[model samples]
Target: MPKDTILVVDDSPTEQRLVAAALSLQGYRVITAADGEEAIEKAAKELPRLIVLDVVMPKKNGFQVCRQLKTTAATQNIKVLLLTSKSQDSDKFWGMKQGADAYMTKPFTDGDLVANITKLI
Candidate 1:
């Protein structure tokens, strides 16, 4: 099988690196973007199998990006998994409403991240 890729999108460098490191160690290729615009750019170019997006970001934000991706034929098939500090059910609902395939809260276990990605990718 072909290798799978994940795009980690977060304005926080620490969060981006943490997710990338954890996912990379699990044998997946990890790409990163600092914010929503960058996430869109990278997703268009890289065509990653999945995206780990953060909710609160400068510029377009994760939900907006997810919507754009889902609506765009070129990028619509790429799965989006929202990774954010937003813990409320409303947040999860909005994430899904915006086309995210999954929603995971911040400080999530590496096992959860890996497992979700495993299922999606």
Candidate 2:
């Protein structure tokens, strides 16, 4: 069976690499975007099974990206998992309000990441 494709979006190269590595280890095909604009473009073109999106980024933030993805017909069905350092209750609420399928904070374990991806996909 073909592995599921997941788009990992984050401004930090380190974060991107970490997330991508974790997903790849789980047998998922991983694509990456450095910023929100790239993320939106990639998500629209690649139509990955899920997107692990960071909330803080240049050009546009994760909330903006998620809102756009959820509203746009081409990308609306793509599941978005917001991953960021913003762990406040309000941030979680806003992320969900923007149409994220799941919200996970940074400093997460690889197991937790896989678990969330497994559940989302």
Candidate 3:
């Protein structure tokens, strides 16, 4: 069977690498985008099983990307996991409203990240 592909989007290189490494360690095929525009393009083209998106980014934010993805026919079905430092309840609410399958904050454990992705895919 093919390994599940996950797109990890974050503006910070360290954060992106860390997330990618964790997912890769768990046998996932990981791709990455440094900002939201690239993320949108990759999502439409790659159709990854899930997107790990960061809320604050140049070109666009996670909410904007998520909203666009959810509304666009080609990418609408792709699951999105908002992985951001935004921990406010309102931020979580907005993420869900934008059609995220799950919202996870930064400074998270690899175990929690894997568990969330497991539940989603």
Candidate 4:
């Protein structure tokens, strides 16, 4: 199978590296962004198959980015997975409402992460 690229958006360097490494180990081409604005720019330019987004970010938030990406025709088809520390039911609801294809919490196992990525991309 052809390798797929995944964009991981997070303000925390540790989280960013952790996710990137996990995805890379699974043979994915991992790209990263430190903020939501950068995420949007990279998403539009790189056109990755999937984006792992964080809810709280600078410049823009994951929900905002997800909404814009989903509403914009050019980038709407890219699958968005909200991987965040927010575990509230309301947050998950809001994320899904904002067009996130999947909502996952932080402290996630590599197994679950890969499973979600496999299902999405």
Candidate 5:
């Protein structure tokens, strides 16, 4: 059984809960952050195996946070999976540039989300 922890970061409470619950059902320990700053703080403290991040958010946005986490040695190894409604090609490009291990657009199914998480974690 995989016991790795995952951090879900999103501004929408509804989205956050959906992601959290799905991962929890898969037996991965789940934690959540409502925005970028909190996400960064929790990622540092928890050292989770993966981080499910949202692009549009207050405080710091997912790309910025991903860059910060990737550049820092302590958190660089933590896999970052960018999940967002921003489906532009440029958005995907920039997400990869910022060190996102994977990018999945919003309106994703629970199975797809779990598949991505499993791949990353």
Candidate 6:
């Protein structure tokens, strides 16, 4: 079977590049978007199997993006994994409420990130 593609959305070019490379190392195709607008557009256009989104981005945040993706018919079924710095319990609860499948804080290990992606795929 072919490896699934992952759409990674983050404002920091450094973060985006790091994640893209890590996922690529696992043999999955990686696509990137700089902000929430691009993330939404790419999610619709690419329809990736999963999305790795960062919170606290300009224009829109991960929570809003997750809700939008879940509410939209075109991208409703796609799994969303929020990778952000929001560590509070309430933040995680809100993320789930917004329809994300998984939420992880920043400074996560590559193994955990890849493991989450693998499990979801």
* Local distance difference test values of all predictions, in order: 0.93, 0.95, 0.96, 0.96, 0.96, 0.94
Give each model's clash number. 0, 0, 0, 0, 0, 0
User: For residues 11-37, what per-residue lDDT tens digits would candidate 5 score against the true structure?
Assistant: 999999999999899999999999999
Candidate 4 lDDT over 1-121, as tens digits, reads: 5389999999999999999999999999999999999999999999999999999999999999999999999899999999999999999999999999999999899999999989987
**TM-score on alpha carbons, each prediction:** 0.96, 0.98, 0.98, 0.97, 0.97, 0.97
lDDT of 6 by residue, 12-72 (tens): 9998998898899899889999999999999999999999999889988999999999999
Model 1, residue 63: distance off in Å is: 0.5
Better of 3 and 6 by TM-score: 3
TM-score for candidate 1, residues paired by index: 0.96
**Deviation (Å) of 111 in candidate 1:** 0.7
Model 5, position 80: C-alpha lDDT score: 97
Clashing pairs in 2: none
* Tens digit of per-residue lDDT, candidate 1, span 28-70: 8888999899999999999999999999999998999999999
The lDDT, on a scale of 0 to 1, for candidate 1 is: 0.93
* Model 5 misplacement above 4 A: none
Q: Give the clash count for model 6.
A: 0
Looking at model 4, which ten-residue stretch has the lowest summed lDDT?
A: 1-10
Tally clashing residue pairs in candidate 3. Answer: 0
Per-residue lDDT for 77 in model 6? Answer: 97
Runs of candidate 3 with Cα error greater than 4 angstroms are: none
Model 6 ranges with Cα > 4 A deviation: none
lDDT of 4 at 65: 97
Q: What's the lDDT for residue 98 in model 5?
A: 99
